[model samples]
Target: MEFLNHFRNGLVEGEDRDCFEKFLSPHVSMLYKSAIRMCGNPNDAQDLVQETLFCALKSFHQINDPEKSKYWMFSILRNLFLKDIEKTKKRAEIEFDSVCDKLTDRKHPEGDFLRAEVKSNLQEVLGKLDERLKIALVQFYFEGLSYKEISESLNIPIGTVMSRIARAKVYLKRELLRSESMRLEISKYIGDEE
Candidate 1:
């Protein structure tokens, strides 16, 4: 039969099928967890996982270390998620620009006030970050690069990348806390006046 001929052709050999199932099946849960975290929605997470699995299947032969398959799968997932994020961001930017153009003709005082407050708070916190820390955070979080990729791109060691990201998180937390405390103090003062 044609099925026998296909099997004889080595397209779906038993060894390849066994290797694929062995390496990929055990990591399905972890992959789904990572996909959910990256996507923030179940449907999108499922799609991401499916896409990652498809790519992994097509290139499973390239995975040299079976022990490191989890990390390899993660790298693939992360890369796909980052590409999706980039495309989404680009679309969002275009839509936001058009919305902003339309909103410019309106006079929404409360909206303006809220936007200014949020912008100022963010700017203050970001401005307090060290230049290197800021760059690392931006590249890792916003640009969606892996620590290894960021290290290569920035010409820094992997250890340095890890440290910078860790330091950036600490600094951001401290700055945010300070900003919140200041805001609360101002709110208290205004309440006392009224």
Candidate 2:
């Protein structure tokens, strides 16, 4: 606690980089452990700590309360961890949508074989739809594009995109029931709507 107070005081007094580094080194392991739990990955935890340290150094002058210094660092680490999760989620969604598009457009015999193996487990109703309907479904739900964007990209009216998405859901309901395992997986992905 006395160490923390001195570290806080140094930050408040605009301590030299070397002095700050001495103080920071002692707290590195503690901060890294906290960050690991927050981020759920070792690499991300290390990054979060580095970022938190950078932020703390940059805004050290604003921390007036030495006693609250620990909380301040934790707050910065938490926010960074959450932001990292959000970025990962967005990237995963984009990659999934890209893969879905490629899967839907594949024309090779091996592609068909692979699709047959895995796609059969989906609510087969999706498989039965025309390529256009499949594309519309994947674009709106899988890719999360707005109706306006979908319309412009598909070269169709916005109203058409809306109706197509709605109809796609109905078709999905009918087809997915054919395979219970696929139905459960699909439900996990789609959820109970937005």
Q: Highest lDDT among the candidates is held by which one?
A: 1
Clashes of each: 0, 4
lDDT (10s digit) by residue, model 2, range 106-149: 66555555445335434234435554565566656654657875
What TM-score, computed on C-alpha atoms, does each candidate reach? Answer: 0.51, 0.36
Model 2 local distance difference test score: 0.56
Show where candidate 2 strays beyond 4 Å.
1-19, 90-194
Taken over the whole model, the C-alpha lDDT of each candidate is 0.60, 0.56
- Positional deviation of 183 in candidate 1, in angstroms? 9.5
Query: What count of clashes does model 1 give?
Result: 0
Superposition error at 73 for model 1 (Å)? 0.4
For candidate 1, give the lDDT of residue 169: 75
